[model samples]
Target: MDEQVITGTTAAEIAASVRALHERGALRRGDALPPVRELAAQLQVNRNTAVAAYRLLAQAGVVVARGRAGTVIAGVEAVAQEGYAADSVLRDVGTGNPDPGRIPDLSSALARATGRPVLYGEPVIDPALEARALAWVRDDLPDPELRITVTNGAVDAVERLLAQALLRDDAVALEDPCFLASIHTVRHGGYRAVPVPVDAEGMTVDGLRAALDAGVRAIICTPRAQNPTGATLSPARAAALRALLADHPYVLVIEDDHFSMLSQRPYETLIGPGHRRFALVRSVSKFLGPDMCLAIAATDPETADRLAFRLSPGTTWVSHILQRLVLAQLTDGTVLREVADAGRHYASQNAAFAARLTERGLPAEAGDGLNLWVALPVEARIVAERLMRRGWLARTGDEFLLGAHPAPSHHLRLTVHDLTAEEAARLVDDLVEAAGRSAPRS
Candidate 1:
């Protein structure tokens, strides 16, 4: 019998065909795809069309290219609220979220939102909210002339910022083990995600330089409490990155300070003086509550103007009510204290867990943010399986990988800040036992 044939005359049709095949289970994860030239001939289309189709697939995270080794189906974990499992008997330490009990109450804030009715032709942003947001962001921005725009959230701001700056297939430098939402945004937009290796001190200078050399048109980085890994940029590392970015002034640099209010570390930025195009996004989700879904995007004038085109009134402006609510909470003395307390709570809990792991002979350092990135003595996936059996759901580091296929990792990003002292201790004991079981026999 003849082998299964894949065919399409255009890029869209080709992408649709591959997606259909994957959906039908005809193409499994890690399965090899036909070479672009071979597939073009089979489909009777131009080579560029095949290339375009593959590019689309790559951006969608449906497939990955292995250079001369050819393209293959991507084995990506579904992007969702991490560490959540339905109908499970496990304690979940994988959901990257602030404790609900700690989120600032908005009842009074919502009540204060009552005012004169906003109508068409009015400014998109709530004037009062804009004033507060501007003041809040201006404190961190190096550029005095940076303009501010509010969006639904960090993800929304990033999507708009990138959309305004880059064309499809433009390379975007993203930290390896990036945030899930950012990964989804980049893939759905059909951009090449160039991986920038992140270490203890946040984004490495060499990684940034390599990404720039690869012709990446944009970069997205987290200055503190980076997702999954919980890495923060050190002052020295931030200086090095800023120096490198100074030479490539045109590259669109986006800094997502997702943990802005809750971070234990000070904000260290990479956007240098005279850097032409850049944006710094600070979302209030971590403290104000995820449901609040508000972020401030501070960018250079040109990028702000470009972003404004998409956010023009009636198209997709963030709700004025939400803006007022965020502002109210941000400015309220009680809420401010609550946010600060929450930050300290997370830092203490993470440190406690890391110390517990250390006492168990597992060297662990709890990084900033809500999670502890633990290096295991065995394959993380294997240990995760063992954990599942012991009734604990943890996130393996592999789920956050970008670019090429990576070597197997022994890292686990556990959301243990919300865990109680007893609960955390129990989880660490389980993890230690799981690792022991999964370790290779001598």
Candidate 2:
């Protein structure tokens, strides 16, 4: 822009211009704004006016002055609703939750699944349902000898897996910035979480090696659709992890393939052959409707037997009714087909959003799940704070970090799949505006 244009601008105009620069990527989060005096003089606005405008943005979380660092663009969450702040109602872009509409309606399926309850003690885990589950498990597990154990949900399976294999206070290697449920499970189980770093290729083998060397007795990892980061484990990384685990056959390996069927990538099995202690857990929560709350875990017989002690059918079944409903749906082809379609839709939507982000000068990446992971040019926390004022809520990279050292990158984990296309587009624009206001004037 011409210097003469700024020279005649009002404080509000300067602010608007600043936002436009951020939107266009001319300015970005964490960049320092020009000094108030310089900006005021440049815009031909009174110093007081510039100061007032800057203060207003700060209060609204658009920007923050960091001691000697001057003022920076607050992170995008700055646009989040701040308790009825006049007209502030930001969109939710955090927590990669599925769109409610995408969930399969079990009404038609459940109607057909009803029948006389299978007799009590009638084959724990419901043989009929287990049969369907076995197919799903086999579809993901590379080894034929892998045994399956059905449980209430992924969490239920995790609890059982730990109970059978790990004593209290045992060290479990888990991805840093793990799923919230996994974090709580490990802590509540009295096990220490040795944080493993996750990257675009999913869990890092070097980090896993470090955790194992730290004396972790077990490791629970996701080969696909990793939570928070929305990263899938790459083939090479998965192979490396499997090779590393081969050296320590005593360590229990639990791989949570939560997005099993819904995932778009070719499934990669991380558990190597002849590994004595290992389990592959797959959850239908994301694809099968979380309400189903059922998960299938295939483990070695030793772990299955231990889980068997607590996994009784009829009285303690993962609800034969629910199992039957899911089974009937899976077999119906319509439900399974719908699930596959939904996965494709989510992947496409996230990809489109990432494209929009790229247009705004932010290089974003999409994975097989319900969201996009964006690396901001500046601090993610600052960007989130800025977006909060604009009524947008988001997740920062810091929250997902697992290691003792902070994650060095500033990134946003966004779940944008379920939202309408128009809503997503508008959100991208608002995020750009927020980024601009917080974005430092170079």
Candidate 3:
């Protein structure tokens, strides 16, 4: 590709030209581009204009900066996502999904959710939903001066919050063994992910301090029922984090309480009362169902105002119908009871599974979320491979790790809440057999 393939004066124009070249197959993936100064001089534009153009491309994932090696067209990498893989014949114990049998039926809520046509210029959140959401999150959040915003889901809210608060390439603190969607979101946005190590008691104090020292602009945390590991923040841990964050009040803190209604553990927050920027997001997915696609974010007024731009009226606003549906289910007595039962059910089932695994000589713990984080004596990949041979598809813990040299994860996240007794027993036996096969021999 010729250097002249990239041509334009302004930032947008330069970005457009590069995009056009890529579209025409003239600038293929991994192809090096001229240095910023060289490109600026050739195009007769300011060096800053060239820099801005590259920034835009990087943010859009069209190109990536390679330090002294200069910029190159980005090769898209396939990211792993949640839910079951299509057309798989194996019994999928790895899918981090809530039991459909436990999810409250939405048929009755649908009737109540409809009625009242919402026109343009109306409020984005349904009035009833907003009121209920405020009450729902009021006691849990530290800050009293909160404004509510509804987004498609917890992931959408995090993406918007980061976009509003930080620039591309800015550092954001995420749990080391992070959620799949979060890792994908941060990578797709071209942001730097600073890994904050999570333990049995949730995000560690030292890890968080290191992230803050690394100049992270934002921190995404799971207050309870953390994904993969299922580590909930203890009160002591939350207090220690609050103390550490006291000096850096302006750093945006986003607590994703995705398992709010169904969490067996009480909510613990890292956001202190005086914290300048924070958002507490609660999605109804766990108890209500994933297809609902509604999450309520109770955020500081300023953060909420900034988030409004991304969720502009009539453009990206979450549907009022969905909001009403969630609100209807949230307030219904029978539905609330069912959600509570679901929480207890998940806890008991996970505990039972953990006990079975422990009895078989593989130590396992019943974590707060929908899954059990079971540690294996051998490498998780080896055990997973062995399990595959035995007609089971399992998720290895390495898939959730961050950074270039992450510690080898020897664990597997298993969702066994919905499994029948016979299936559960067979799975335990198979897992133990797989681990035994994978263990190193003398």
- Residue-by-residue lDDT tens digits, candidate 2, 204-286: 88888998899998898888888877788888988898898888988998888888888898777667887878888887788
Clashing pairs in 3: none
Ranking by TM-score: 3, 1, 2
Q: Higher-lDDT candidate among 1 and 2?
A: 1
Candidate topping TM-score: 3
Report the C-alpha lDDT of model 1 over 1-442, residue by residue, as the tens digit: 1124575788988888888888888889888898888888888889999999998887676888777888988775456545366777678888887899999777899898777877777899887887887888776785888888889999999999999988766899999988888898887776778999999999988889999999999999999999988899999999999999988999999999999988989999988888999999999988988888889999999998998899988778888888877878888999999999999999998998888777777889988998888998788999999988888888888888886664787899888877776787678778888888332211
Candidate 2: residue 338 lDDT (0-100): 86
Tell me the deviation in Å of residue 121 in model 3.
1.6
TM for every model, in the order presented, reads 0.86, 0.76, 0.91
Q: What is the Cα-based TM-score of model 2?
A: 0.76
Model 3 residue runs over 4 Å out of place are: 1-20, 34-56, 67-70, 437-442
> In angstroms, how far off is 72's CA in candidate 3?
2.5
Q: Report backbone clashes per prediction.
A: 0, 31, 0
Off by over 4 Å in 1: 1-83, 437-442
By summed lDDT, the worst window of 10 consecutive residues in model 1 runs over 433-442
